[model samples]
Target chain A: MSAVVITVTSGKGGVGKTTATANISTALAAMGKKVVAIDADIGLRNLDVVMGLENRIVYNLVDVVEGTCRLRQAMIKDKYLPELYLIPAAQSRDKTALTPGDMIELTNQMREDFDYILIDSPAGIEQGFKNAIAPADRVLIVTTPEVSAVRDADRIIGLIEAEGKYSSDLVVNRVRVDLVRRGDMLSTEDVVDVLAISLIGVVPDDESIIISTNQGRPAVLQNGSLAGQAFRDIAARLTGQTVPFMELDGHDSFMKRLSKLFKL
Target chain B: MPNDRIKIKGTSNGLVITLGAGAWPRLVEELDALLGERASFFKGGRVALRVGARLLSTADIEAVGQVLSKHHVTLWAVESEAEETRTAAAELGLEVELEPRPISPEQSRPTAGDTILIRRTLRSGQVVEFPGNVVVIGDVNPGAEIRAGGNVVVWGRLRGAVHAGMNEELGEMAVVCALDMSPSHLRIGDYLALSPADDSRTQIVPEMAFVHDRQIVAEPWSV
Candidate 1:
């Protein structure tokens, strides 16, 4: 099957790109689709840790590109998901180890085997970001509800549009429903209005994410986590499923409404 | 093309170099050699350029700047009859026109009657700079900027920072108008005015900003 490459990038760092990549790829794999996630950040490699595949990465993206190892040797199988694999980044190398051509070549080799190839792109609009988007059929720009994040997202969208190749979809992460209800934080609509891109996911700010991240387990594996469900919904949407958008602030529980009304 | 179309003249300000009609690369090479011939005399000197109808890109203008800077020369002002060259110069933060000095009066015509028109939404990090009048047919998003030597007009919402009369000579004559004007700030030549907090952005009002009594002011645009 031909794999659809989706590069997840945010212009600014620390906006949950790695976390989203880990969770979304896990969710997509758990859906029984053969998926492989590539960690494009060479020096600051963490997608391996987030995906719980760090120890299994005997061969990495750099090794595959540098001819030190075969492409299949670098593909690390996930712990429980038999259909999922990860091409981890080299911890010892910088982003220059792999060029855009190398990334395109790697994805081309894997396209015949996997149904979806999720590229966990490094932050910034530098060489790493370019290499990540080089083979992308579509791009997912992750941003938080903050103005700085949104502004950076706009610049990324502008850059992608300047390339005029891949279609960009926005995934707004870490949305605080409480702050939005209190009018202190930006809402999804506000972010979408400013960004003017199609929304794929709206993950609420959940503390379980931090616990899950440290445990080397994505929240998508959790049953009751709202953020986990959001990732699943994003995966379903990616497969052309008409999954309803998450009701982060809406469909609030009775207790949630009471707290919001009391705050108002 | 012929010999060298480069004419360098000394004015009250450092220098006024007029670039006549020729291929852009050839003109740039000629300018580099001409400045290199007397590097010591041009050291720490500011010069204004007059390129008549030579449509140049932002990179092209910066190439010229780099060629001049190689010889310790500062290319400050760029007076071009072409709208593209002027916009490129203005985008580079160089003065589109000199400070009301006797610039090249013999270069076909001035940029007074010229205007640049952009028909796209200027997103963040995108800029629109023009020597004369500028008319944008789309929204100017936040973090985007427009620096105009003359009047500025936006057909859509203007939510970015915009400066009119950047050349300072037309400070009083320049007026910036927009439909739904809620810019981050407004500037007219040397004067700056932080946009008044426009809370009621829902109600659209076409307004014009101009310098009056040494202060920048915005009023409803009736004309």
Candidate 2:
């Protein structure tokens, strides 16, 4: 089966692009799909660490592109999931070591072997971001609810549209329901209105996500975490499933009480 | 085939280059080579490009202008049949129409108003400029800008910066009207004003802004 190459990018740094990529890849693999996650951030590679496979890396994406290692030799299989693989970036090299053409050719070679190929794009609108999206069938833009992050997301969306890639979507991360309810933060609707793009997922702010990252494991593997559920829902949506969005604002009970009072 | 893409003709005003149909990058490359071939003949010359029916973005037009400027050619105007291309040229503060040929009085004067009607939203980082009046049917989001020689009107929200009455020759009588009139910065002629920080309430009536006593002011739009 041919793989769908999805690129996850954020124009601003520390907005959880790497976290989202690792979690989504894990969620998709847990659903019995063969998934390969590529860390396109060459100089600052962290996907291997997040996936808890740093010690297993014999080769990397730069090695494969430079023809020093075979593609199979560079792919580090996950310890728990047999269907998942990780192609970590070269720590010693920079973004210039890989070009857009190399990314496209490399992904094309794996198209027939996997069901999903997710590329974790580097921060900024530079060569690394271009390389990640070069072979993408769809793009997921990750952003926080802050104005600065939303502004950067808008710029990235404009660039993606200008490149003639029409399948780009948005994923709002680190959304605090309490802040939204208190009118201190931008709501999901406000972000969607400004960006004018379809919303794929809304990941709430969770402390377990940081804990999971520190322990070198994606939070999506934790069944009890709300952030993990959000990633799972996003993965389900990616696989053509219609899962309802989680209610994060704690307003459902309030609304129900208000309706009951009106009836009484 | 390469030579046919760019046809240069000398005129009394300047050189008029007719750019043939093709991709924008290839056209830029060919124009670069053509300029390089006859640098002395084209040096210190004004150019009016005749791009027939091709819609060019701001970046594409800027690239072409840069190529000409590198060879000491000043791009004074751009003549195009496409409305988008004309608007793009006008946005760069370049004349959309070339210098008039010897014309009869009837052909020289027209009866229509010089106003541009834009029906699309101006997103962040997009700029629309014209030497005449401008009427937009969509929202002007934050970071977008509009510079007009005359009046400006927005049927939707006006949260972006706008400079009206840019051409002093046209008389400083320009006004800016918007359905929701909270702009980051507003200018009428030489006067400038910023939206009040605490005025976050939604506007119920349309508002018009104009220069009054050497300062910009906004009032309820009536007549």
The per-model DockQ list reads 0.10, 0.11
Candidate maximizing lDDT = 2
The candidates score, on chain A by TM-score, as follows: 0.94, 0.94
lDDT (tens digit, per residue) of candidate 1 on B1-223: 2233678888876699987643455568878877777888898998999887555678888999999888888988898765556667766777777666454434423365568787656678866666678899878888889988888999988889998887667876788899888889888888888876756656678998888899988888775
Alpha-carbon lDDT, every model: 0.83, 0.85
List RMSD in Å for every model shown.
Answer: 11.6, 8.0
For all candidates, the clash counts are 0, 0
Stretches of candidate 1 above 4 Å error?
A: A251-264, B1-57, B60-120, B166-171, B196-204
What local lDDT score does residue A185 receive in model 1, on the 0 to 100 scale?
96
Q: Provide the lDDT at B187 for model 2.
A: 85
User: How well does candidate 2 score on lDDT at residue A200?
Assistant: 96
At residue B37, give the lDDT of candidate 1: 76
